[model samples]
Target chain A: MRTILSVLLGVIAVTTAPPALAALNVFACEPEWGALVTELGGDKVSVYVATTGRQDPHQIQARPSLIAQARKADLTVCTGAELEIGWMPMVERSAANARIQPGAPGAFEAASHVRLLEIPARLDRAEGDIHASGNPHIQTDPRNILTVAKPLSDKLAELDPANAAYYDNRHADFVHRWTQALQRWQAEAAPLKGVPVAVQHKSWVYFFDWTGLREIVALEPKPGIPPSSGYLAQVLEQVRREPVKMVIRAAYEDPRPSEFLSEQAKIPAVELPFTVGGTDGAGDLFSLYDDTLHRLLEALGHDSSKP
Target chain B: MNTTRFVIAACAAIGALSCPGTGFAASDQELKEIQQQIQALKSEYEEKIKSLEARLEAAEQAARAAEAKAAAAQTGVAAATPPPAPPPPAQPVAPAAAGAFNPAISAVLLGTFGQFSRNPDKARIPGFELGPDAGAGERGFSLNESEVDLAANIDQALYGSLVIALQPDNTVNVEEGYLQTTSLPWGFTVKAGRFFSGIGYLNEQHIHAWDFVDAPLPYRALLNTQYGDDGGQVRWLAPTDWFLEFGGEAFRGDAFPAANGPGHGKGAGSLFVHSGGDIGESSSWLAGLSYLQTRAGDRVTGADVFSGRDHIGIASLVYKWAPQGNPTQRNLILTGEFFHGLEEGTFDGNRFDQWRDGWYLQGVYQFMPRWRIGFRHDELDSDRLAGVFAGGTLDNLGHVPRRNTALLEFDTSEFARFRLQYTRDDADLTTDDEVLLTYNVTYGPHGAHRF
Candidate 1:
């Protein structure tokens, strides 16, 4: 009887201990994405962003330590649409965790949920190197986050089923609060709508779509071509003709071209948080919109809140 | 007191009856006296301390009771309103990767395009021979290479790949078809069917994965096969961070078109040993030794077929220096390799020299994250150059002189590459200019080739 009693005590001691808290491992390829995940996940997830807002996510090296982290990750996510054509292959190989491989249960490609932009008319290898599925940087729009939130909530629930209800509640609360926030920002930005803006790259299509901002000029002669002296002169003429207010740039891209154009045009050079965590206020998944909207609102010379 | 001392001393004397230094018997009377004395002392100390402690506890309880009564009386007056306490701050969540697809199937589309141009001074190359100097124009995109790789994971442990790519010669071909071993025993993996061989570091990496647009000359000069062979390779790794790989391939001779002719291999095989690790905080390297042997039908010698054997060995060292907050804004990498090969051929005709040897060294510097430039120099020599290079009739020929080359290149991404290289042909053959630009793409799923 005593032996049995001792065995039961041993079992009870082993079974009843609280599980040790594991640091949440979060990986964001772009700063905007990182900022958004950070805001939504808050202190619950540990973030390891691959690219700063200042660096291009398209050309990140496949560092060994990054691979080791991805191998053990409870979840692995990336920007799809061939944005990571050079880097993703290495990540898939080195991230040996079965769950994070292409079809693994914990693996995800984030671009699948949102409405893609900049689809190529001729989608062949011979046409020139282009993303076939669509342009991958779709996070510039607040509405895109609305579509991603459902999947984000589902993923968080799947990863931590123990906290499913908590995540679901947080996601619901975030959606409601974000909807309200967007409305206010939209009202403030209403006058800024149809505002003529000059840009270096075609990265602001989503933002332009949402805000109805007019692209008055591009510094580049063609899309993706860095502006030449002649092209810049032409853009200056175009901007002067259209009377632009601001010249915009994606956070990760070089600001030199737009800055030059802004200097010539005598307008403020506005840097937008194209990816999550690209801006100071970019914190959560919903904050992708927050950073972009706040920056645009500020660029348009408006008070941000509670006026 | 003196009489009492005398009595005590007398008792002591009686107790001394139990003598020392001897195994004396125990006296119950003596034991009883000692036990009684001990009990008296214990009782005395215990009673004193116990009384003192009891008094202290009584005083403490009285004070505590008074303090509690006062506090309770105050609380009862305003129990409905609780004092404000600061709320705990929310903790920060850690950053992590994005998205998930169930283990059954996940798909991603990959594509690439590039332009090719050659120096005008170089002789006109056939549209097919030159990388960029195709039949038509300079720096054109019609021949841009693209591919889509569809990948699927089965049973959560086996990964399968299917690839379709626009070949450099302007045709789509099956670039990859193989299964990668994922969940293996102690890092032991077996790859069957067609896959790239782990012959060299650059051999396994895709064209898109290269730091430069065009491949280094050593790969073409040393290893006969262009990319890899369709073979089965089994790799084993030890806990000590060392790896051993062995593979044999049975491929059609036509699969690998050799420069000598549509030959050099009917079947091929290779074996390699690789071990690499970090030397210090930020320094790491891969040290490896490998060998490859192949058999192909030779048609260049005409009626008499020639068979050849290539023995290759290499040792390379690369160092990377990246300092924080650099004014240059560059991740400067200096890498070089020394490769040697001795290839001997056997033919039915009176062949003079069947042995060939060569080596190369190269350096690459990444000026920016996606933009890099590199340079390489190589020399190839053979003791016996009977008929191949010196334009000899059937048997007699001059010594196969060394062919030396200097090349420079630049790269953007895997799928898109741009290069400007000059190969110096110092052999008896024509010293022609050879420049090339190649582009790569993957379709279906963006998975890597076999390592």
Candidate 2:
């Protein structure tokens, strides 16, 4: 009995003890921001990622632990072009943390720093799932990541003044390395320019812009809607007329649609690592681009090695 | 005009005289002709200048009118149509003010086809009295409870949500409507209006989120189809790495287990505490303890009417396991709850004391993506007594009541689900078997369910 009592007491002590305070606590709505925070803040910040690389950011289930983390967070970073419209508002309301509320300094949005794409000419719900603000998937291009990192680092420094110098230095180093990588990737991906591709969804506009790939058509009749038989037939007919090289989809998207198109069009179906940790080779932001370009190059029958 | 011509002719004659004898001087007739020519030229120049000025004035007037018309058209277009799309590079980051004011609205449609070996005559738990709301659903193809939800943030400090359920009989029921504080300090939140009490783990969840077709026996018998009442609640979250929370509620005691009491007072109340944390990368667990108390005034049970105090206690635990990266592909969850209660009251003019308890354990596993299977076991225990009831007993308590259930479910997408469930219940004198097929579809913006 005495031994059991001691064990119970020890367990209680361990659970009740407060965790060691880090310089800053960040709550990230997606894995990409979590990785970005780690890159910029290093050991000065501790991050909690709300959604994994494999989960769609548009919808997520709420958990009490997420609320607990948000309540104590000093900063909340997210893709704020309505990507998290389903759950983020409820989380903010439930957390009751003034620091992370809308219009507060602690709330940082990645989409705010970069120029968005696909702003609709008209606003209407009948057009299927469309973002009024524009496409929220800005992390597909590494250049957008650099654009976001500078402002995010500044926000982190403002939130944690003691680590201002640390954040500034990290931001500089990241920018220098990212610029060099962009130049190299552009040179290596020259063969991919003007390659015609069909996409499962309209989520890769930024990526195609950077690589100079042309989107021939899409599997979905409209954004965020599944394809119908009639739409699939139309796509197949277009494929016959056009020089379609491959079909591409994000790792999180269902692969069946793209696979169906590939079988009919006789093109390779390639799944790109849309974010960090989406695939084995795409462990970080740098490798995510590397793997994306390499797979597209390989699909086009070009050697993936440096020329 | 005559004076101008004379001056011209005189100048011409002076010019002829000054050139002395080298050329012939102008004659009178010649000078007169020169004067007439000068006069014609002067009139032509004046008419041309007048026409040019008039043309310039008309052009300026037309340009001014065109400018006004263009300015009016720009404003008219803005007023008549929606705002033009802003430039993509310079789009504002601020959230859409119009969309923010509109509450999130969603609807869920549920339909089921069921078959039973025996008729379900107000399904009872053998030893416990039931309320009017405790009836099992109808057999054959039936429209089950459909729900419409509306939720919105009222302001910076308050949020509100409402759920209205539509029964198969076309009766509308307000399942929940409450306003909660969002900006309370010290991890404190307060809620007011009608809501389900936080007395048990499963009580707060809606029917659409249930893993099984029907609720556990304890919920039907002890709480009379789950405890929902007009009330107020306060909750506090502890500042620690572990998930620790404490909450309490005070409600009007007009629901089951406390009927015919003062309806407008704080006659019913409960307290609960829960704690949870991740065990590792792929597993998590939560445990909770809850207590409820109510005053019963002429509460009816079977053929007897009782009046006294009742106390109930509940303990629950939930465990979840998933692979390291994704839960959609594979996961398993184990949930269990135990309920115990004591009632001390007068039954049909005779004083009696009774003790009852019930428990259920269930497990659900997603063996593959979009497919899941689940199993549940239920049992109830009650004290057996002879000659304690002046009227009559509902059933012999010598045998313990038990139930078993199995279910298979498939999800077409995040917004739709299909499930088939089979249950064998031995809660009464005879055993009963039931099979149920259900489909649920959701539309519009639905908020995520809490885990």
Return the top candidate by TM-score.
2
Model 1, span B1-451: residue lDDT tens = 5435445644554555656436554467876775666556557668889999999999999999998997788687536533221112223322232223332222222222323233333422110012121122234334444555556554557767665666546676776678877755444556776767666667666556555444444554445324464657776543221222233333333333222323432565667765454334344455566666655455342234545544566555545544321212355554555556554555444443334444555666656544556666654454434344344322213333233333344433333345544445333234544444444433333333222
In order, the candidates keep a fraction of the true contacts of 0.04, 0.31
* Tens digits of per-residue lDDT for model 1, A73-113: 55666767677765665655545445556666666566777
lDDT of 2 at B332: 90
Model 2 clashing residue pairs (backbone): none
Scored by DockQ, the top model is 2
Off by over 4 Å in 2: A1-21, A54-59, A93-96, A118-133, A162-166, A198-202, A216-243, A252-269, A304-307, B1-90, B93-99, B261-266, B301-303, B367-370, B390-396
Q: Give the Å error, residue B222, model 1.
A: 3.2
| Candidate 2, CAPRI quality class derived from DockQ | acceptable
Clash tally for model 2:
0
